[model samples]
Target: MARVLVVDDDKNTLKFVRLHLEEEGYDVIEATDGRDALKKLKTLPCDIAVVDVMMPFMDGISLTKEIRNTYDIPIIILTAKDQIDDKAVGFEAGTDDYLTKPFETKELVFRIKALLRRYVDSESDNDPIRLGNILILHENYSIKIDTKTIKLPLKEFELLYLLAKNSQRVFSREQIIENVWDLDFEGDNRTVDVHIKRLRQRFSHLSVPFSIRTVRGVGYTLEMNQ
Candidate 1:
């Protein structure tokens, strides 16, 4: 499910938006003001953020700027102000879509889905995985970090590719083996760990700390700073 953050000063507005988003099978996180919104955003991972333009403590424009600076996640601006300048300012602050107040719940839902589709489709268009200072050319099965080139065996390369493809999400060793290696590869799960360790070593010299994290008793994840 997609995680969405809704920010609005009015309690009624926040509740209403959260209820509608939950009804649509989305995981909703809410904040009553822009400052609260930023705090919540940093605590959890979210796919998109819905922000109200006229918020307390900080406005949507400022909040959008902060979000854009740290993450490439999609943002939709919700507001009572419908002026052209207001819309332009939101876009300038990196909002992916704009919605005015009193919008129909269905219309809001549609806009959110459209924005998400566009963002996801753009990522798919890239074909290869690129993050921070590292790039993995999946089609060519090659990897590079800035001006440095790294070599990998087929197994190691495939393992790195899968982790980087799904970047921040955790994956169990069994899941990694099934997707990166053969479905029926009867090797020990430890093989997955070995390759991940090697890949991290090659990337440790880069500016961004790209590490393969071990989620104890759960799995592993590639956490790249970008």
Candidate 2:
């Protein structure tokens, strides 16, 4: 059974949602606020989370950022705020989807099922593109060269994954930023350079057939070193 974590300050809402989710054959976990949700995440792993934006001691946006950095689970923000800016902020914080409050239980259930299916299917599709004998696991967020398992910071991992996926295809720095950072980023271009430097340092000792080659005046690509 897929476990769903529902975080809301309103106890009545939690009870209502939990009852419906349980009836649909999902294991439901409850938290009164974002802080409590994080605590639950540390011990109780859930497949996805339904988080409310307005809450005491750490709102849903902040919680979504933290979860994106640490966990691989999907988040759906439940909020009464229907303004575009609010939704933008939630998306920038890495929420998988957004649902405004006064929502129907049927719609909520349908969204949950859809998001889970979408993420699962995408994970299978990515399938860890291999370059120069190095395997990049999209779902696992780790790189493997031979028997060694190397973990990277979130940004560094994302950069590496993108390049690996498009091996031999050059990606300009602008394209890299657009894809990896999305629209909410305000960092300068050097951000990609710094991450590339770190990735090179990590893979330096590995005997891989491919390397991240910098194409001056353009961008970068993972190319065969033959």
CA shift of 199, model 2, Å: 15
lDDT of each: 0.74, 0.80
Q: Each model's number of backbone clashes? A: 0, 1
lDDT of 1 by residue, 1-226 (tens): 8999998888998899899999999999988888898888888878888988887789989998888777657787886644546665665565656677778889888877865664555344437677777778654446777887664544456677787878899999899878765464434576666666656666676565477889999899988654
Worst 10-residue lDDT window, candidate 2: 81-90
Q: Pick the candidate with the highest TM-score.
A: 2
Cα error of candidate 1 at position 100, Å: 1.2
TM-score of each: 0.55, 0.60
| Candidate 2 similarity to native, TM-score | 0.60
Stretches of model 1 off by over 4 angstroms after superposition: 122-226
Q: Which pairs clash inside model 1?
A: none
Candidate 1 accuracy as lDDT = 0.74
Residues 1-226, candidate 2, lDDT per residue (tens digit)? Answer: 8999999999999999999999999999999988899999999999999998889999989988888778877788887744545565666666766688789999899878976765455455668777766778867667888788775544567788888778899999899989876654544576677677767877797788888999999999998788
